[model samples]
Target: MSQIAKTKLTQTQLDAHWMAYTGNRQFKQDPRLIASAEGHYYTDIDGRRIFDGLSGLWTCGLGHSVPSINEAVAKQIKTLDYSPAFQFGHEKSFLLAEKITEFMPAPLNRIFFTGSGSESVDTALKIARAYWRKKGKGTKTKFIGRAKGYHGAGVSGFSVGGIPANRTLYGQGLESYHLPHTQVPGTEFSKGMPEKGKERAEELLNLINMHDASNIAAVIVEPMSGSGGVIVPPVGYLQRLRQICDEHDILLIFDEVITGFGRMGAKTGAEAFGVTPDIITLAKQVTNGAIPMGAVAFKQEIYDTFMETGGADYMLEVPHGYTYSAHPIACAAGLASLEAITQQNLIDRVKEMSPIWEACVHQLKAASPLVTDIRNYGFASGMSIAHIDGEPAKRPFQIAMRMWEKGYYVRYGADTIQLAPPFTTEKSEMDSLINALGDTLKEQH
Candidate 1:
């Protein structure tokens, strides 16, 4: 056992820190703390082995404690601890930026770095608006986001995001509107992408009519919704959105923060869905969740617009960045992570293992009567749980807690249970994780 597993903790220590996106009171009543993780398993503080069901909140699809990433981080901190992000340049950051384009679709080669996924979303939104303003169309300030679309928690992302509970407490946000979600009625238990909801892409026209396209800067959606319950876009849905955006002269942004890297069987959700957007927001698996990093890949034209319009060569163009925009350590971690992904052909591994993952997770439909819908794509999946006592979130929380007690870690949010097994997960590990979840769901009611 590791030394961390042996150390005991006190209530005072736990009380001093407030967790995010967690039920703090309930957690304090019965705490579940992890001391270490390796590959596809986690070691709890008591040294109990727990299967990694959600891959560290869909961040570590390459699994935990990757050796190459760890080595790179250690070497980087010793060599170049920090660099001024504003007017400085680093070799690894430039190399890492170029490396990221290998996974991005064509024409989206320009990269801008950020500290986290929220910052990436905000950066993408700002770029979209600024791009229009640079072209002398400053009126193009509105953004269109879809219902149930989760951009991130930043004020800009939260304003455009469609999750009600996330925005309710925060007062008015940006001048943004939402398009209806495309979960279309009667598409329950669909495998991969459904066929009926392609028409829902047309709803963007209604929004365009309500708020003229001249006022709209961009339309953002996750090619495959992650926290919003692993929702998959229907066939031709993204293509239609692209067509509408092209016709109305609005930029399209794909928040691939959760679906990028090898999670979608392809390098990115855009490649998986066969549609290209003007900008793509990325995080999570970019550095395999080993280090904090995020990036936005903009089309060549967007990058050129700023350069062409700036009055002086020395003056700032976009004038937006974080102190850790491209931290040296994060760049090192990202370079190592991407190199490892290419060396191991992990993206293809995800593609090959997807069928097995789908079959295993969908079996939960038979394991519990409470399952109302099951949706999956590649390595990611989410199942909707029936509400109990008019509480939609309770059953999922209960099921996840039961799974945790049984030595598995899964993510529970809103009204669903989400699972994203490690990309390198073997068939047995997949079976074990899904079977444990199935058994846990059966005991929920």
Candidate 2:
């Protein structure tokens, strides 16, 4: 009943807290707990230094314990801890919303805030359907998501999301179809965007014909699939998708949760890939992982449609929002993080470091026969491992655990090992991280 201050966790205490996306039974038997993090490394409970390979789940490109973000959070909690979400407003929220628009592409100036990436996906879906209804085309309610696309875990997002394990047990979600994934055969180790899969984007035409574009609300995808193993869209792939959406009258949504905010070496994925969507969902790095926040940015037309058609100023334009939509503390964190990103020019930092990153990781192709494929774009990368016993995820799990013991932190998902080093990482740190990974793979059975 009292506060537990001990850094070490008892077996009973560990059992009380169930972890998400983890094998709980195995983890409690041999846990890897991080006690603190600074700069680009984490210190475990036993005080061993571990390199931060994945940038805190792809959320901390500026690295950990940033001074500006820390100070802003402390001052905000003292000044304005919380604020009412409805009808009322806070100055920080307005400021944060405006700052966010500066990074988004032009005409996508309207902003809506939420609490996490999942919520942002759901909010974008709702906005798409609402926009159709306001235009008197309520029949436009279907959605199209690509195979291997990862939106998030909410009902709307989960249903539209394409990962089988994430969707199988949940049953049906919103009426949605999936386009084929872009990992075209025979194009495994190509650098940047592979040129072979441009036709894959044309699969959207089949889905449009099968269900009629008149009934479709939108097509949503990650510009570069992060959780789906960093599968980069082929050259001209996104452009073709944008062109198709234009002709069909269907809205296009880019779930940039993983690729937004400097991960793609640009203001947003739309800028990196040069393919703008009608709606863009964002989160993770909005506050540099210091505070939880997400947002949806859309073209001004969507917002104007609701305002012009709504009955009166007293009526709600759109009857939806979370209680913590724009908490003052989160707004403060967001503003500080954006300011730090701008001042430090971290986006350019990613661009400068990406070439060295790509060359270092690609060397693993010859390190061992177990590595089957490597995909990368900007600072994000993933390497697929040869499946053992037809269990694709097993080898990656073993590889990651070995990486942990060797003092590096990387993400293992599906059958791949993913890496996204902090933008501040130097060339020497990059070499050490990649060399360690190569040695680990060669050591694996």
True lDDT of residue 236, candidate 2: 96
Once superposed on the true structure, which residue ranges of model 1 sit more than 4 Å away at CA? 1-7
Candidate 1 residue lDDT tens string, 194-310: 987999899999999999999999999999989989999999999999999999999999999999988999999999999999999999999999989999999999999999988
What's the TM-score of every candidate structure? 0.98, 0.98
How many clashing pairs per prediction, in order?
A: 0, 0
Q: How many backbone clashes does candidate 2 have?
A: 0
Model 2: weakest 10-residue lDDT segment is 1-10
